[model samples]
Target: MPTLQRVPALVASGQLAIPVAEALVALPADVLGRVQAASIDPDLADTAAFSEAYGFPVEGGANCIVVAGRRGEDVRYAACIVLAHTRLDVNRVVKKLLDVRKASFAPKDEAVALTGMEYGGITPIGLPSSWPVYADARVQDAPEVVIGAGLRGAKLFLPGAVLAGLPHVQVVEGLATPTPDA
Candidate 1:
């Protein structure tokens, strides 16, 4: 396993492996400057695999999911943050939030393309300016959590409060629920 490094050190190395690294440089110390990152094998970016391999507690990580919905000819997108052990309330909540008759997870290609992040690494930070990021209440309750660094090879660690405070972020009540089968 690769060592966890401070964001500044990663930036100083000039070998930043993720697109979000460049963006993170501009964040205030209260945010990105305090983030910790660890390099991981891209193949294990998925939550279960990454947690088992890296010894990260599953609940200590958050997953960001992209949902797309359409109303008439206007299409909208939003990123939802939930704990890995929970399920996003996509059909009901997301659809209602988007004010569309239907909403669904965007296809893999669309998510990666629009977010400018890899499929397994989409994050609320640095998402398109117009997109809104919604966090489940439970996510904001975490002391610190791991999230994608916009590259499958890296994971970002930061205070959950910092994440809840990102621009264009909304903390929604009950945005997620324990997975039905969990």
Candidate 2:
């Protein structure tokens, strides 16, 4: 395991955290210390690569992302967390729930550009302050889930309950469905 930095020392005290990277810095100290970071391909989006390279099962990992959609006049951003074995149907489920005309995965370039985190490494633990987060109910039942460490080749293993404490998370049951092969 790699070195894990405790939250308090890694983050400035009393600063309203932004960027999933900074938010991760706000996690409980004990949990923060349990995380590890690894470096991998910058553009890798699929979980198989992350699993193979990191020695974790792709289908058993957590998939965390921030999505962009229109809600009235606002360009709303919401974080969606799912199991790697399942796929979140952004158009049917996410968009309709947001009451928007369209909701798509944040464009690859846009995701990388805005989060300042690599595409394969986007994790909900630390995300921009403006984004709302949603976690599929299934994830909460897992013994442990692997999430990006805001960087590639690196992932964090934490108890599922920690995700529920995120300020903006809304637990939903149908955010994702298991793939046929899974």
Candidate 3:
């Protein structure tokens, strides 16, 4: 059986992985300064488990994502962030925001391929230059929040104000919700 690879840490804390640490180090000094992360052994696939395991508080963290769609012959990609408490209206809000006939979550494989990061590890800071990112206003209200650092088993804690400073990050609202099946 193949052995699972562990993440490296930016700092020698023996907690998270190194690449995640590198990214945190690379963040502009003007942005939120580095903060500590809590280690957990659970699949943070959803908000509840993610919040519970990390103890970072869902009401504070922002749900960042990459959304894409095609309009006629044009394909577009967008980096979007939503608050854990309020879901973005993918159809009504994103469709209108992108001004495309159809909008959908970017294909999982395509996202992983483009980012060179695991499914849950993708973050806006290291994405391709073409990505247009959007952040919700709520993120600006928190003192510190944890977000993916481009890998599972790793996360970065920074002030909410720092995420607002990313280029092309628009303050949006209503990106996701507890759907009947979700």
TM-score, every prediction: 0.90, 0.77, 0.75
Model 3 is weakest, by summed lDDT over 10 consecutive residues, at: 1-10
Kindly list the per-residue Cα lDDT of model 1 for residues 22-98, writing each as its tens digit.
66666776665666777678888899888887877888889999999998888899999998999999988888888
lDDT per residue, candidate 2, 76-126, as tens digits? 777799988888978888897777887878887888777777677777765
- Looking at candidate 2, the ten consecutive residues that score lowest on lDDT are 8-17
Best candidate (score: TM-score): 1
For model 3, the local distance difference test gives 0.64
Rank list by TM-score: 1, 2, 3
Residue 93 local lDDT, model 2:
80
Candidate 3 has a TM-score of 0.75
lDDT of 1 at 87: 93
Order the candidate numbers by lDDT, best to worst: 1, 2, 3
Model 3: per-residue lDDT, tens digit, 78-131?
877766676666777787778888888899999888776667756665677667
lDDT of each: 0.80, 0.68, 0.64
